[model samples]
Target: MAHSEIHLELLLGKQVLDSTGKPVGRLEEVRAEREGDEWIVRRYLIGVPALLERLSTWTIGLAILHSLGARNLHGGYEVPWEQMDLADPQKPRLRCTLEELKTLEQSNSQ
Candidate 1:
């Protein structure tokens, strides 16, 4: 199999678009695991919630938002590794629609 390399830093904070060219969110965090000397990506986290998670303040941020009556304000998406098109690392995009991705809440419930 052929593989290409992209610096994680370049992907961070990049706005990810959907299949139809609609903006989804920024690439805030990347979920990966070590395997046989390789760090394999599992998924890409996007949006404000992802940013909070990357900063290790997800719980606290959510609590504050809820307390402020902003229950619906916190949101994000979890794009599976296979769902993201990284061919253009500078402008990462989703292979699927936003609706097909798992929301932060949905992933938390699982």
Candidate 2:
């Protein structure tokens, strides 16, 4: 298999599209784990909650939002690495429908 590299900085704020070309959300964080000598990406986190978590303010941010009547506000998706197509890097796309992905809240509760 051929190996490729993409800078995290470039992907961080880029919007990701679903399989049918619908906007999902911005790429906020990447979940990875070490495999021998390299770190392999396990999932990509997208949306406002992911961003708040990345910034170390998830709890506070959510509390504030909830208090402001945004009770339905929720975290983003925890897209499995295999579900994302990074062929273009600048324009990441999902390999499946948005509904097929697990939301951050769901993943956390699992």
Q: How many steric clashes between backbone atoms does each model show?
A: 0, 0
Error of 1 at 106 (Å): 0.7
lDDT by residue (12-46, candidate 2, tens digit) is 99999999999999999999999899888889999
Task: Return the top candidate by TM-score.
Answer: 2
The residue pairs in collision within model 2 are: none
Give a tens-digit lDDT track for model 1, residues 1-110.
77667799889999999999999989999999988978989989999999999999988988887899886664799999999999989889899998898898799899
The parts of candidate 2 lying over 4 Å away from their true place are: none
TM-score against truth, every candidate: 0.90, 0.93
Backbone clash pairs in model 1 (N, Cα, C under 3 Å; residues 3+ apart or in different chains), count: 0
